[model samples]
Target: MMRKIENALAVALIAIVAVLPLFLKFMQGVCRVQVPGADIAVLHFVFLFASVAGLVTWREDRHLSLASLSSVFGEKIRRPIESVKTGGASCILSALFINAFCQLVNPAQFDARFWGMSVRFFFASLPLCYFGIIAMISCKKGNLIASLIGMVFGLFISMGPFTGILYYLFGMENVPSLYAINDAWLSFSKIALLPIIVIFSSLAFFGMPLFLVLGGIAYVLFSAGGGYVDVIPLETYRILTDRNIAAIPLFTIAGYILSQSSAGSRYVAVFKSLIGPFRGGTVIAAVIVSTFFSTFTGVSGITILALGPLLAVVLTGSGYSKDRAESLVTASGAIGLLFPPSAAIIMYATVNYFSIDVFDLFKGAIIPGCIMALSMMATGVVLDKRGERPKFSGKEARDAVLHCIPELLMPAFISVLYFKGVFDLFEAAAFAVIYAFCLSVFVRRDFTLKKSARVVASSVPVSGGVLFILGAASGISYFMLDANVPAILSGFITQYVKNPYVFLILMNLVLLVVGCLMDMFSAILIVSPLLLPLAESFGVSAVRAAVIFLMNLSIGFLTPPVGMDLFISSYTFDKPLSRVVKGILPFLIVQFAVLMLVTYVPFFTEAFL
Candidate 1:
C-alpha cells in the first residue's frame, strides 16, 4: 500500500512539474496573482522536485536504512519515537525550526560571511546528522564508515573552494529559487525541510510526487518573492550549431550500436585467434581486441564488458595464468579512453568549443594505444614465462578472419563515410544504425523486431543518462560563464606559467587527476570550458588540445577509485581491485609516457590536423 502510494505520488509530481508553466499562465490569465517569470519558476520547481524524487528513489531502492533515536541521541531517557509516524513528525518540526532560523537571519550579512561558509556548514552538518540518525536505527549496521565517507563527499560538493568557484561561474544572481534563500531561517528551511519532505514522501509511493508538487509551489513562491533571477536569452541557442558539437551524440550512438551488434563479439574472436598462439598471447589478444573495438565503441564499460569474457577464455586456453589473464584484460580495457568515437573525446570537444575528426583522432591515438598494449603484453610475458603459448593453424586463422569480416567492415564503413562527406555525423550515425540493424536481422538472423525494439529501448537509457549529464554540465557551464570563471582561471594560469609547453603539461596533469576522480562526461563538461580557452591563449591548436585532453582522461580510466574501466575489469575477472591495479601499473606507466609525448610533441596530433 505504501509503495503504491509512493508510485502514484511520484507520477503525479512529475506530471505537475512538467505542466506547471502552462497551469501558471492559465491562472495568471484567469486571475492576476502577478507571478513574475512563470517559466523560470516552473523550471526551478521541476529541478528541485526531480532532484528530490531521484534521491528518494535511490534511497528506497538501495534499502538504505536510517538510524534510531537512541543511537543518535545516545540512549537518552526521553526517546523521540518508536514508529515512523512519530519520527517523521519530529523531522518535520526540526526542519521547520531550522527553516525559521534561516529565514530570520539577514540576507546581506549572510551573503557577506555565511554565503561562503554555507558550503562547509552543509558538509559538516548534513553527514553528521545522517550518521547520527543511521547509528541510532540499527546496531548491526555496517554503513557507518560509508556514511562518514559520504560526509567527505558532501564536503567536495559543498565546502570546496571549487564549489564557490562554480557557484560564482553559474551566475550568483541566477541561482534557483530553492538554492537562493538568503535568510538563515529560509536557507535552513529549504535544506532541512526539503530533505525531510523527500524522505517522508518517499515512504509512500505518492510521497515523491507530492514532494515534487510542493517543491514546484515553493519555487513559484520563491521566484515571485524576488531574490535573484537571470535567465539566458534564447539567442544563446545558436552555440549548439558548432560542427564539432554535433559529433557527440553521433559518436555516442555509433559506439552504442556497434557494441550491440554481433560485430563486437566477432572482433573479440579475431583478436583471440590472431594473438592466442603467442606467449602471453591471450593477454595480447585482450589488449588488441579492446584497442580495436574501442576505435568504434569508445566506451570503456561496454568494451570491458563485451571483451572481458572472450579475452578470459583465450588467455586461460593459451596457458596463461589466471591472474595474468585477468590483469592483462583489465589493463587493456583502458584503451576505450584513447579510441575515437569516445565519450571522453566528444565531451572534451563539446566543452572546449571545438571538434576533431574522429578518424584523425583515431590515427593519432594509435602510437600511444600501441604503447599501452605492448606494455600489457610484456607484463603478461613476464608473469607467465613458463606457460605454453597456443599455436594457431592456418585453417583456424582463415576461419577466424572470415568470421570477423562483417564486423571488420563496420569501422571501414564508418571511416569511409566520415571521410568522404557522405553524411554529417548524425546522418553517419543513422547509417551505422541501419547497417547494424540489417546485419543483425539479415546476416546474423538473430534479431527479431521485438528484440530490436528492446535493444533500441535499452540504448535510450544509456543515451539519455549521458545526455542528461551533458545538459546539467551545460547548465553549470552557463553559471560558470556568468561568473567569468574562464577569465579568472586563464589569468591564474598565465601568471603562474608563461611558457606554453609547461602550461600544456601542467594542464594535462590536472585533467588526468580530475579524470581519475570524476566521470569522464561530467569532468569534460565541467573542466573543458575553463581550460580550453587557456589552451587557445597559449596558441595551442584546438584539435591538439582536445586530443591531449582526451588522452589524459582515457588514462584516468586505469587509475584507482573512480576508474570505470578498472571497476568493469575487476567485476569481469572476479579479482580484487588492488591486484588489477598492481598488474596494470606497467601499462599505466606506458600510457602516461605516451600522454606526455603527445603533450610535448604537438606533431603527434597536429600533423593530421
Candidate 2:
C-alpha cells in the first residue's frame, strides 16, 4: 500500500512538473495573462519532483552507485560488507530526515506562503520521503535491526538540533543532559572525522549509493566543524530548484519517450537509405545514427543498448566485420555530447562556478563535435574492406526520409525554438517533451496510453538518479568552497607549473581518470569548480576550459579497461570485455588525436563564440 501511494504521488508530481513550463508559456503567450505564483510553483514542483522521484527510485534500488567492490568475493564476505553499507546509508538518510524535519517545523517557515498555498505543505515531503526511503532501504536489505540501531545513532549525533526543536514544540524545560550528550557526540565526531570519512569512502566502493555517501560526508564535515548541518539539504534544494536544472529531467523524459518508440528503427532506415549506396557508407550511417540518439539520451549507454543490435546487423549484413562495426557504434556513443540541446553542456553551464553562457558553450562545442564525429566516420571509412556499394534507390530513400521526418527534424526544432527566443531553456525542454510525446504517441501511434505511462514511469528513476546526484554533489561542492580548496589548489598549481600548456596536459590526464570514475553530470558538478580556478590561472577562457573538459570526458567513455562504453558495448554485443576493448582501439586512437588537436588548437572550440 505504501509503495502504491509513493508511485502514484511520484508520477502525478512528475507529470505536473513536466508540463508546467509549457502550460505557463501557453498562458503568457496564448492566453495573454500572467499566472500568479507561477515561478514559485515551478520551483517548488521541481523540488517535490526531485525528492519524491528520488524516494521512489530509492525504493526501487535504482539509485546510481559504483559496482560492489565485493561482487567478486564469496557470499560470506560480500553479505556482511553489503549489510554494513546498507546500515550506513540508512543512518545517513535518517539524519537527513531529522535535519529536514527541523527545517520543516521552523517557526519562520510556518507562515511562509506562495500566493495562497502554504509552502510548508510542500516542505512536508522532504522529511516524509527521507524517512520513507530509509524504511524502504532497511526492509529491502533485511537489515531492519541494524538500520534501526543506525537510525538511533543518527538521532544521537543530531541531538543538539533535534532536542532543540522538540523543546520548542513541546514547551519543555531546558534539558541539560540532552545538550551534554550532543556536545560529547560532536567532540568525538570532530576528533574522528578522518576515520569516519575513510569508512564512508570504503562503503562507497562496497556499493553505498553515491548521494548518501556524499550527503553523509557533508553532514559529518559540517557537524564536526560546528557548521549548520541543515545547509546540506538546503544546498540540495538550491541545485534541484535552479531554472536550468529543470531541463535535465525534462529532456531526459523526452529522450526516453523517443527511444522507447519505433523511432530508432525509423531513423536507422533513413540514415542507411541515404548513405548505404557508397563504400564505407554503412559505417558512416552507424556513426550518424548513434550520434543522433546520444544527443537526445545524454547517456551513450542507452544509445548503445537501444540501437546497437540493429546497427550491428546492418553493418555486418553490409559486408563489414562484426568487431569493427560494433566498435564504431561504441565510439559514436559519446560523440554528439557536444551538440546543441545537450544536457551535459546545459549542466556544465548551470553548475560552472565561473560565469558561462550556455549559448556560447553550445557554440563552442559545434566544430569540436563535428570534428569528433567526422573523424570517427573517416576512420571507419579508411579501415573498411567492403567494396562497391549498392546504387542509391531514389524511391527507397524518399520513403525512408518521409517515414522518419519527425525524428530527423527534432534537433532543428529544438534549436530554432530556443535560439529564436520562442521559448526559454526550460520551456524549450518542456516543448521537446511534449513534441516527442506527440510524435511517438499521437502521430506515430507507437505507444498506447498504458505503454506511454510505463515509459514515463521508467524514465522517472533515471531522472531521479541523475537529479539526486547533482543535488548531493552540490553539497560536497559547497563544503569544498567553504574550505577554500579551489584557491589552495590553484595557488599550488601556478607556483609549480610555470607553463599553461603543461597545466593543460595535466588537466586532460586528470579528467580522463575522473571521467572513468564518475558520470559526466557528477564530474561536472564536483570537479569543474576545482578545475575552473586552475584553468583561469593559466589564462584558459572558461568556454575553452569547458570544451576541453567535455571533449576529454567524451573520449574517456572510450578509454580501455573500465570505460563505461566498453562495458556497455560488451554487454550489448555479448562479446568478451577484452574483445570490446580491442575493437574500439582504432577509434579510440582517432579520438585521442582529435582530443590533442582540440586541447592545443583553440580555434575549433573558440571560433564560433
* Candidate with maximal lDDT: 2
Candidate 2 residue lDDT tens string, 1-609: 877776677667767876887888889899998998897788788888888888878877878776567978998998788778767877888888888887777776546577688878777877887887887767774788778878988888888668757866886658888888888977988999999999987887777888888888888888887847878867877787788888888887888888888988888788788888877787888888888778877778878887888888998888888887888898899887888778899999998735788989999999999999999889978887766678899999999999888888987899899999898888888888888888998999999877787788777888898888888888888888888999999999899999999999999999998777777887898899899889988889899999999988888877876677887898899998899988888888889899999999989878987
Give TM-scores for every candidate, taking all chains together and pairing residue i with residue i. 0.62, 0.96
lDDT of each: 0.53, 0.84
Model 1 earns a TM-score of 0.62
Residue 81 Cα positional deviation in candidate 1, in Å, after optimal superposition: 19
- Among all candidates shown, the one with the greatest TM-score: 2
Candidate 1 lDDT by residue in tens digits, 114-195: 2123322222222232233333332324434443443333232222222233444454444444243334334453456556
lDDT of 1 at 423: 51
Question: Which RMSD values do the candidates have, in order?
Answer: 13.8, 1.9
Candidate 1 regions off by >4 Å? Answer: 1-261, 354-387, 499-502
